[model samples]
Target: MSRAQIEPGGCLILAGTPIGDFRDASPALRETLAEADIIAAEDTRVLRTLLQRLGVTTSARSVSYFEGNEASRTTGLMEEMLAGARVVVVTDAGMPSVSDPGYRLVAAAIEGGIRVTSVPGPSAVLTALTISGLPVNRFCFEGFLPRKAGERRRRLGALTAETRTMVFFEAPHRLADFLTDAAEIFGVDRRCAVCREITKPNEEVVRGGLGDLVSWATDHARGEITVVVQGAPARVVDIDGALARVRELVADGVRFSAAVAQVATATGMRRKDLYEQALAKREEHEDG
Candidate 1:
């Protein structure tokens, strides 16, 4: 939480553009864009279109500051700020700094003693998370997993035990693959939601188990996609009870490893603990 300076040479404004429907644009966002001395846009053309749609005309200087030249352009923006120029940064859509460009410029502005503030508006992440109907008390934003299958699965595997609702940004083309991998690693029954096209007329939020979402995404749903996945359920802490459950399952003909795994998933117990305890219990019974 960086605070803005009451009196500074200049200010850097991070403007949040509408994710989909231009109508979602806020009055403050339009005002900030209109009053800017210099506007650094991720895509100048997109900014131009947005200005026309919002019906807000500005004489401010518009410069491209997308990912390609983010590093190279930050220096120039910083110079303008130090020279008592008010610069506003706008991404193609949504907030400037979240999973988008502006972080470098914001950090530089703060470091250079320039004021930093935000014109918050529509956010795909927040919108999706809200409609997800999942637990919002605790959540994490994991924007974009690895594009490659192996790497994506590895990433999902690490998050298998995450207890917070997880939000992710993914390309439409990779939605199915991501859901499939998420299902495999997080389990087929794990709850999740896929939000598409955000605020636009075609906006859709498909909510279900990871397995169901995987099937839905196979249709290659278009437009920007945000995924909200329910975290792993709370784990049961009774090792002895968990081992007893495992033993019962095994005695009923479930394989030892499978029984342990099943009990671990059901009770949030560790498979290793259940396995070792079950074995020790068996050995102790034999000794008696």
Candidate 2:
């Protein structure tokens, strides 16, 4: 165990584990592994493996806390927190609640008056953004796209005009379908990078438009997928162009709100700004 210690209380600590390559793991995380009064890990086996690799011994108890068991586990963890235990939550990678399983627990802890804190570390979202070849200055992390084909298409369609660099996590099996759908919805030539197995031996980032990516993926690809879609081109300040894009998504059965968001994102304009402008345009169109 490390010398530094965690105070026992109903405090929730969210630790970010390395996405890949254990050597990238931070020393502070190693200390947390030793000091936490209880570790609520996404996978007990994975957490144990990380601890073994770091050569850290723990006096704290370990418990499995993942999507399937989160609801049930929340109660138990909350109880420990209420008992003044320093409960630390971690997923396999990145932050606890982003796309991982710890969100519910964190929400519960907050509602129960438990103090929550985070140990910032490597995040696939940040890593992908850094290497995405897209503007990182203004961006949004969308986490994961919807899994179903219809839902996913509708979702991507709404983002076609989003101007900020958009980051997403996807499964390897659905890579081809997702890319193909993205190409159709966002345009085949829309720039994107499918970052795979980052920071690992087989890590690769395939940069191209959605069309080219679909072609590359057709040959078969593997590893975790993080797709970064380039924001809409800057020429969209032309209200005509923005309206055209919005109408396209709306025609595709996307909701008006989503359509507005995508258009604003693609045009690098504020949502409220676009909405007011869009409403005026809609009224003009109706009058004409």
Candidate number of the best lDDT? 1
Name the 10 consecutive residues with the lowest summed lDDT in model 2. Answer: 1-10
Itemize residue pairs with steric clashes in candidate 2.
161-266, 162-265, 162-266, 163-265, 163-266
Residue-by-residue lDDT tens digits, candidate 2, 1-288: 332244445688889888888888788888877888899998999998989987889998999999899998899989988998888888887789889988898889889988888787888998998998988999988878888899998778777667789998988888899989988877899889999999989899989889998878867578888989888765537777888878788889978888888878667678998888777877888899
- Positional deviation of 118 in candidate 1, in angstroms? 0.9
User: How many clashes would you count in candidate 1?
Assistant: 0
Clashes of each: 0, 5
Per-candidate Cα lDDT values, in order, are: 0.86, 0.84
Q: What's the lDDT for residue 46 in model 2?
A: 91
lDDT of 1 by residue, 1-288 (tens): 122233556899888899999888888888877878899998899999999999998889999998899999999989988899889999988998898999999889889888888888888888999999999999999998999898887678667667999999999888888888888878989999889998889989888999987767888579999999999877647887877877788889988887777777666666787778888988898899
